[model samples]
Target: MPTRPLTCTQCQPKLLAYVHNQLADSDRRRVARHLNDCPVCYAAYLAQREVAQELAGTIPSIGLPDSLQLNRMWLAIQSDMNRPRTIPRPQLARMGVACLVFVLALLLPWSLDKQQVALAVPPPPRAPVVTASLNVTASPESGRRALPPTAAASSTEAVIPAAKTPDTPSNVQDTR
Candidate 1:
């Protein structure tokens, strides 16, 4: 049989088709003859055929598990079913006390008149102190120039007042 010659580029397209038995017999023979003579086409045909066969053999056929949705639903149900039902007793008591205090605070002013409640706090009690006396006398000559008196009792008990300058004598005049 006389064969029509084709380029490597042209033969490549029909190469797989020829191997898979999809091409017309004359076309297949032409491609097959080219593949046998050309190393590049022959390698490409083998790789393509091997890949096609491998892919056909390896495609997944089994379905995913059906329990996935059921597991998710069960978890959700368990979470909802097992949620905490009651607050701790102490917390509940504290909440009740707070509510009561709030209500009392709100109602207290309305229930009491200005005169009924006094806001003034009582002053704290004064601390007690002990007082003792001792007699002391300044010398008569210097007595007339006596120092001021203070709370601190004496040589025996002299109470010397804090120092304050005497007012200017009325008779003194500013000469400046």
Candidate 2:
């Protein structure tokens, strides 16, 4: 009598063993029959076989050296591990620079306060001075009469009155 065909779940676990020829003859035959009839199981079996073949072919077998040489190498490594490590000069210099920067960063704000106090003296009092000098001469070609110096000065002062009384509006008129 023909046995019932194996499902993909049953076939999956045996694929690696099937590829490696490690499955029992009866199980191998059953798995082979299932793979032939089932496309999913066949594809899975092919993938597993490909991966196994690739891994077996790509990996190199490592052989150990004699125990005497292995022991010597291990002792040498142990000695190196046990030895104290000293910081190199360049590494110490870098650490010193980093510490100096940290100290300066901590003290910078405090140092700034002292300099700010020294610079906080009030400026000297002086009379307000007008930088612009207004000349009231008329253009000779235009032949227009110019205002007297006193009237021009009063008009100019009116244009820019003192800042003490801000509410007072200047009565300057545009003469152009």
Local accuracy by lDDT, each model = 0.69, 0.72
Q: Per the 3 Å backbone cut-off, how many clashing residue pairs does candidate 1 have?
A: 7
Per-residue C-alpha lDDT of model 2 across residues 135-159, encoded as one tens digit per residue? 6666778787766654222222233
Candidate 2 deviant stretches above 4 angstroms: 62-176
At residue 166, give the lDDT of candidate 1. 51
Q: Candidates' TM-scores? A: 0.33, 0.35
Clash numbers, per candidate: 7, 0
Q: Which residue pairs show collisions in model 1? A: 149-161, 150-160, 150-161, 153-157, 153-158, 154-157, 154-158
For 1-176, candidate 1 gives per-residue lDDT tens digits of 66578789999988778767999888877887888799999999999989878876786333544587779999999998999877678988899999999999999977864322332223233444556564454667765765554454333333332223253233432221
Q: In candidate 1, how many Å is residue 36 off?
A: 0.8
| Sliding window of 10 residues with minimal summed lDDT for model 2 | 153-162
lDDT over C-alpha atoms for residue 69 of model 1: 78
Candidate whose TM-score is highest: 2
